[model samples]
Target: MVYIAAVVAVVITALVVGDDTRGAAGDPFGADQAIRYIVFLTVGYMLARGLAKAGSWARRDDHG
Candidate 1:
């Protein structure tokens, strides 16, 4: 879980910081980009958590 979150964070950070697809227009950490990063991070976290929970449930069902 921690590993998944870490990877997501790193990937998002790289995209936002790099800003290759979307030009920075001067500020590296532009407010719009910051918002995008935040939104993406939140969604990634939620998905990771849901996946972890589902995996645990499946494992329990398999054993029992």
Candidate 2:
């Protein structure tokens, strides 16, 4: 959720600011770059979460 929100904010700012020229801070990314970054973040987060949950287990005992 945080990643999605951040990317959205960045893309919105870039579009609204309307400046892609290289400045002291370097060139700002466009919408396409933002989309790619979000995709990478999503994939990396999924992999990390999957690894973290791989050892967890839960059960409901009916014999209790």
Candidate 3:
């Protein structure tokens, strides 16, 4: 499940970055854009991890 989420996140992030670059007039590969993409992707992965952990805990509690 984590692997699937990671793959999907990477693909989506790449697509977003690519689109942003193409649509913008100035340099799309600027430092700010790169930083934003990195931040967004990292946050997304963190959220996914947190949710997965929460779900696991919930299941364990229910079983017990």
Per-model tally of clashing residue pairs: 0, 0, 0
Taking all chains together, each candidate's TM-score versus the true structure is: 0.47, 0.53, 0.48
Clashing pairs in 1: none
User: For model 3, what is the C-alpha lDDT against the true structure?
Assistant: 0.64
Model 3, 3-61: lDDT tens per residue? Answer: 55765665566556545545657644555655576678678888988998877745535
Better of 1 and 2 by TM-score: 2
Predicted candidate 2 versus true structure: per-residue lDDT over 1-64, tens digit per residue: 8867876786786676537465667545667776787788789888988988886564456453
Candidate number with greatest lDDT: 2
Assess each prediction's global lDDT (C-alpha) against the native.
0.67, 0.71, 0.64
**If candidate 2 were superposed on the true structure by all CA atoms, what would the RMSD be?**
4.2
CA lDDT, candidate 3, residue 16: 62
Regions of model 3 farther than 4 Å from truth? 1-26, 58-64
